[model samples]
Target: MPVQPTPGTPPQATSRQQADSAQRVELGATIRRLRKERGLTLVQLAQRSDLSHPFLSQLERGLTHPSMPSLHRIARALGTTQQALLASAVRADPDVTRQAIRVVRCGEGLGVPNVGGMARMLGSPQLGVHPVEYRGAQTDFGDYFDHPGDEFLYVVDGEVEVDLLTADGRVVHQLAAGDSLSYLGGTPHRWRALGDSDRFRLLAVQNATDPLTGTAEPHG
Candidate 1:
């Protein structure tokens, strides 16, 4: 039989609420610690992460909770991953559920568009390697961009032309279905769709941590 508590009296409910409040406080402190360690003010972090300043302040004060996606952005701005921050939060909470494994269903990827295409984040809680699907990149040439860490790409559907612009010279590689390419980080590169297909699809996995912030390298 279920026990009903009279108005203004409930022990179990009160305990649960207290626990949740404590957890929120701990999470906020953890985020504040990380932000300070990175030498980032709330304004700087918010600008870099595309988050609003007031929201960040509220989060740091434990006055509000952030959704998973917002937490991911905050973690990235602090040079960490969402998985790491969640692990920290869980460590402080006594009522934690198992988090060793995660599964993302098909057609539910986080989609973000770039210069010439769409990039879908393959899974949540980004870890060591960031996996993304690049599709609908129908351009004659890509704006050369460079960032920290190595990159790998596999052509899953159609052919494409990739140009690797390094200090040595300009190298072009034409990739077809089932073709793959791996390149070192810091190499300026660009790509373009080929063979007259309406859309081109590729699986690009990057192991870079440094945020991309620059212009096209001069062709030399």
Candidate 2:
């Protein structure tokens, strides 16, 4: 026998469960794609991340979900941030077919949910380039970490200040809204919002690594 639901009402628990399942599958596919792009086999990734090979295989096959710590380890092993993997999972399902163009609409970018503050990746995934949008009250210089390439930042909305400091704690230059900066990466730098609003938005582009090979291309 079949039971009918009331009008305008659905099975909330079942619907939620289905949504979670779909997300798990999508995340698995994303991880698998990244692993292949980095030329890493399941066994290799497992060894690098210190996770069991069988567990990683199950994660990639959508048989299980990974905890935050596990995901972070996997991301580190893959030479990417956890934010990127999460964004990929939310933005789209795995697409092996390469596209000539990719589009992201207003309010439709992939949010970096795990990261504190508001940050999102703009547009579809592009090779060797990461375009990010950041909206927040301030940024910390201590959080200014280093990676392989260079960076370019533009103030898209509100006002902010950027500081470029030398290794010995000297401020080389400062930038305000409507001003842009480009510097070779590996230099210590950071920024913060200004004015009464205490809000700022920025568009930053930086070099990205290949998920399959885990190698970064030089970007100017």
Candidate 3:
């Protein structure tokens, strides 16, 4: 009797190929994250690489396929060679499904919590942030300074003063929730929880390397 492949079971070769396809998604995400982290907008990247803005946006959004030359150009602009991207893509585990992301409490997981002490991990670990809580007045907020990315704030509850700093130690802007601010990330920054109330709550979303990315605060 001739043997037939099981209806539910994929052949080893087919499985291996599928795994490769999955890695493509991860590679695409990495590309987008790196691009955003560099604070280079699609328009800027296009200008730098001489690529069309639409095409570049599609590539970053993972909606289109980028040719080797195009990828190479983008890589050059990002200051990383194509080989590094390729290596990362290759090292990605095929078993890891990109769509099955889980939302965990900031302090619970090995991730930075955003505002309200809650971090919603969108789809990938690379795509989310949680609320960060700053306690005490005049607190230095160690490890809580300017970082290499942009960040957004949403005041969940309570009150706090968020101060941004420039190279010259000047306060550029200040805000309290119900109030929000967006600024170039990674530039020395600080915040203080204000109000005579017992709780000070705020949500901060910055580049994944914001150091605070892995930490979470409790919502009052």
Candidate 4:
């Protein structure tokens, strides 16, 4: 005799399990993509990350469960930070792709207020690429207002008073024209304008979180 389960329960349970398995598969695929992107073979990754062949194979095939530490090893072998890999995974997963990012402004000689100074994205959407902008600093204060993502700034004009907040807290930096700065986005940073110059311009690059990636990152 067969015992029927409650209505909708069985299907829901199956869906959950399937979703979990799919994510595992995507994680494996992401690892492999990164590996190939870095020109590393399975054996090379095994040696570099201190993982095993059959185990890694199983992971790549999404046929087994891997601990966080194990995944981290694979991540390191691929030469990319783990957070970026995880972010890729989230982006690849349809389950987490509900948000929409529409283009805002697109024109010449126009700038919008970003986390810091004005950001110019007055081109095609592809020019926007990842969610970031070219920011400028004025009056010694920096254009960064402390957000998330790793960042770099190449000074195109003027001097800057760059303040950075890292894992250890706040530290101020004096950046003159042409000085480059790179740091984590999660680090709180505020820049004050400096010298006789009224503003500073820099090409700011950062990989920002989509709404879904937000759950994993901290709120500033």
Q: Distance (Å) between predicted and true CA of 167, model 1?
A: 4.1
lDDT of 3 by residue, 1-220 (tens): 1124457775764554454444455557767777788898888988998999988766555455554346556766776533334334432453325653444333221111222232222223333332233322342343244334456776666666666566767664445557777777455566655564336555555443322232322222
Cα TM-score per model: 0.52, 0.58, 0.38, 0.43
RMSD of each: 11.3, 7.1, 15.4, 15.4
Model 2, position 187, has a per-residue lDDT of: 62
The sequence of per-residue lDDT tens digits that candidate 2 reaches over residues 95-155 is 2226525465555444443222466665344445767787764443324444444788888
Better of 1 and 3 by TM-score: 1
* Top lDDT hit: 1
- Cα deviation at 103, candidate 2, in Å, is 1.6
**What root-mean-square deviation over C-alphas does model 1 reach?**
11.3
Report the C-alpha lDDT of model 4 over 110-208, residue by residue, as the tens digit: 233433355443222122223333454345443334434566766767777778867787788877767888887567666655654436565656554
lDDT of 1 by residue, 1-220 (tens): 1234457867866544454455556567778888887788989999988999999898777667665457667766776644344434433344433552334345433344444566555522224455677776756874575545478999998889999987789999999989999988778878888875456898877662522221122212
Looking at model 2, residue 14 earns an lDDT score of 42
Cand. 2 Cα-lDDT: 0.62
Flag regions of model 2 displaced more than 4 Å: 1-77, 81-98, 113-116, 139-142, 163-173, 196-198, 218-220
TM-score of 3: 0.38
The CA lDDT of each predicted structure is 0.63, 0.62, 0.50, 0.54
lDDT of 3 at 50: 95
